[model samples]
Target: MNLYAIVLLVIVLTLLTVSLARLGKVKTKADYLVAGRSLPAFVLIFTLLSSWIGSGSLLGGAENAYKHGFAALWQGGGGWAGLLLIYFIAPRARKFAQFTIPDLLEARYNQTARLLGVIAILFTYTAVVSYQFVGGGDILHLIFPTVITADLGKYIIAAFVIVFTAIAGMASVAYMDVAIGLLATFTMLIALPILAHHAGGWSAIRTALPASHFQVLGDFSFVQALELFLPTCLLLLGNQSMYQKFFSAKSEKDATRAVVGWIIGTVILETVIVAIAVVGSVLFPTGEVHERPREILAYVGLHGFNGSAALQLLGALLMGAIFAKIISTANNWLFSPATNLVNDIYIRYISPEASNKKILAISRLMVVLLGVWALYQSQHIDSVLKKSLYAYTIYSAALTPVILAAFFWKRVTAAAAVTSIAAGTVITIFWDTPFIHHNVPAVVSDRDAIFPALIASVLSLAIVSLFTTPPTPSQLKPFSEA
Candidate 1:
């Protein structure tokens, strides 16, 4: 194996070792699902950072930066906006202190709402995991082009992530993220300046690429930018993986403090990721990367550092960081929907009295099933950029409005919440289908799913809430007002 391939193999083995070490601790549902609600602020910060940055930023966001230069920040900017809102929401989420978002959904709304929320999460989180698989495959293929094809790499990544995630659940996902997060952060920070200098600095880059790349919209219309912005913003505002971290926090203060660190980490790392991609664009502007822009980050990691042995070693570590982050993210997104199935559906309905061992066993099984499902999904996706937005739209449009309402709007009834979630979920799922395209007005069908789904969600919520009876104070007591 080459140095890059060896580095990646070592990173994967280290992560597996950490996961196996945590396996003995998974004795209870809480221990498996939310790290026993004992994660301190420091652990929470990196886990949250690692979870949030994932393939969505490293590959998908990097693709955007490769094509649009600084304007790719539009995607990252959406998260920045969401982080600002989450700063106010984290303490409230920790105060609620539940294993899953569905727990909070059912507590605030009805059991029906909780069930629908789980459905949305399954579709969304699994899709998120699928793209992480794709990114992982891309990394492996870049490292060992002769030995591993991207298609085979997908299965390899799928198996490893499934096994690692099933081993210790959230404890494994959370603790491993601490190391991955730090490595990715420092590697990106150190690599960006070096790559920029190697690319002949900012002036050369500006002269080589189009002026539109430097522009705010980057050749996109306002509506197109909004299409990119809303999904990410909405996804972050209602990301279940993030709220799970809050529930995993040791205290409300820890959750809130973690968000502060998360915001700083997210802004810097995402920006640096994009900056690195832009530098890579200048270095290798065409050929294979031009066709598969999503691989730009990995391509840069493999080829960006040249000249000295030290630089070559940095390249290997940078590639390892990308590969590691993809695994960390896949574990997180994969583990989340499994928790929903085990905690929300199985425990709530099928076997409330099941032993801790049985629940743990079932949780791991769900992870394996879901990993296979996500792998199947990875096969169908042609672009990581489009897949990221599609998955984000599923959760953002279907769940975000009602989730925010549960805490902010006293007049929102369970009926309205159910209606809104249903409307958003249905509209987004069907928006691009052949049936909708052939029958619906071009004005509506031509637009991205986010607009119609979000409008339907918000309008259904407001109009229905106005017509229906308001929520009882009893249901409202558990949720903290923001």
Candidate 2:
């Protein structure tokens, strides 16, 4: 193996070792599901950072940057906007102290809302997990092309993530994320100045690339920018993985403090990631990464520092961080849906009397099964950007409306909540399906799914709530306290 490959392998193996070390702590469902609600503010900060900055930002967001230059900050900006709002809600979420978003769903609305919320989460989180697998496979293929094609690499990635996730559950995922979080943060921070120097400083980059990249909107029209912005905003507002992290916090203070760090870290890291990709665009302007720009950051890690042995070592570790991050993200998104299945569906309905031992075993089984399913879907989706947005839209449309209303609008009846969830879920699924495309008007079919799905969901919620009876004071009690 080459020097870079050897280094990359060692980094990945070390992360796996970290995961295995946490296995003994996950002896109960509570520990496996929410790390026993013992995570302090510092741990929550990094885990939250690691989870959000995964394949979506590394791959999908980078691809957007490669194409659009700085204007691609629209994607990251969406998250920033959401985080501002999240600061106010994090304490409320921690104070509620639930295991999953679905737990909130059932508490605020009804059992039906909880079940539908699970369905939406399963679809969205699994799609997110699949692209993480695709991203990991891209890194593996970039490093070891002759031995492992991207197609085969997907299976390898799926197996490793599933095993690692199933082994330690949330406990391992959170702590391992702290290391990965710091590694990615410091590595990217260090790499950017070197990359900028290699690109001949800011002036050379400005001269070489199209001026559009530096523009606020880039090549995207207003509607196109909104298409990217809405899904990310919506997703961040209602992201189950994010809420789970908040729930895992040791106290309401911890959860609230974590969001403050999270806001600053997210803004810095996301912009840096885009900067890395923009510099890469100047270095290697055309090729497979140009064609499949999702791999642009990884491509740079392998080739950006070509001459110095020291720089090459840093580059290899950077590449390894990218690879390990894909694994961390997949573990998180995959483990999230499995938590929904076990904590929501299995324990809530199927067998309420089950032991923590059985729940722990079943959570692992669910992780394996969902990992296989996500692997199957990864074969069909062609673009990480498409999959990322599609997955984001599903959660945003189906769940964000009701979730925010639960925390803010006490008058929202269960009828409206249920209707909104159904509307959003159905509209998103059908808007992009082949059958819907064949039937809908050309203009409607050509538009982004987020507009239709989000509008349908929010409208149904508002109109239905107006027509239905307001929720009782008993139902309104949660928001009053919040």
Candidate 3:
């Protein structure tokens, strides 16, 4: 096998061993779903970092950087902005101590709101998983271009992620993330400077690319950049996977501390990712990567480190890290929606008295089913950058408003929360469709869904809550008093 393939094999083997070991620990619903609510701050930090900086950064954000340069940070900047707010919200999220964001919604709002939140999560998280598969396929194709095509690679990655996620659930996903996160963080950090050196440094890069590539907004308008920023910010604010990590913490302090580390790691790693892609764009200005910009990072991991034997080794390890990061992220996202279905929908509504074993079994089945769904979706996705934004918009516009209101706005009524959720979800889903585009005025149809969906959601929430009866002390107690 080639060096990249060998490194990938080693990573898969290590992940399998870890998953199997954790699988033996899964004897209860909480164990399988939330790592027995006992992950320490250190483990939580890496898991959060690994989960957040996935295909969205390595592929989609890199694609943006390749084309528009430093402006891609607008996407990463959104999460950084959200993380600042999350530092205060982390302890509160742990205080709520629920398995899913829907749990928090049900606790703070009502069952109908919880159901809507679950619907939004299912659509949003599954698409997130799909692009991770797309990214994984790209990695595999880079490593074994002669043997495995991207389409075939998608099936292989889907199977691997499904099996890994189903084996030990959250414990496996989180622990594996610790390893994958370290690999990626260290590899990318080390690789960037060397790649820059190979590319003749920042002076060379500035000379090689367009002037817009170095600008704040690059080639994009303020509206286009905002379109990138808002979805990412909204998604991070209401991210269910993140809340699940908080719920899995050993203590409120651990959860809060983890966010501090998570923010630092996210900032360092995301900036490094964009910088590497910027360097890669300088090295490979045209040809295959020019046609498929999302593959730039992997292309760099394969070609950018060929200066010496040692650098080639680093390149191979970097490829391994990218592949492993994609799997780690897919595991987290796939397991999250399964938790939603099991904890929020199945246990809460369908099988309240289900044995731990039955719930565990159903959870695995859900992972496989969702993996298949994500794989199917992967086939239809045209662009990772657009797909990431689309998925982010769905959750951000639909759920972020109601979620934030639950924690911060006591006057937000159940009726208003439900209306807001419905308004956001429906509008985001239809905003880009042919029907909306043709029927709606150009003024409305031309803009992204975030503007209209968020506007509708916020307006409905405020207007309805103002007209409707305010929540009672009991209804507000879980969020306010917790």
For model 1, the stretches where C-alpha displacement exceeds 4 angstroms are: 480-482
lDDT of each: 0.92, 0.91, 0.92
Cα error of candidate 3 at position 182, Å: 0.7
TM-score against native, each model: 0.98, 0.98, 0.99
C-alpha positional error of residue 277 in candidate 2 after TM-score superposition, expressed in Å? 0.9
What is candidate 2's CA lDDT for residue 156? 91
* Residue 346, model 3, lDDT: 92
Check candidate 1 and list the clashing pairs: none
* Residues forming the 10-long window of minimal summed lDDT in candidate 3: 473-482
Candidate 3, residues 159-266, lDDT tens digits: the string is: 999988999989988998999999999999999999999899889889999999889999999999999999999999999999999999999999989999999999
Clashing pairs in 3: none
Alpha-carbon lDDT of model 2: 0.91
Poorest lDDT segment (10 consecutive residues) of candidate 1: 473-482
Residue 167 C-alpha lDDT in model 2: 92
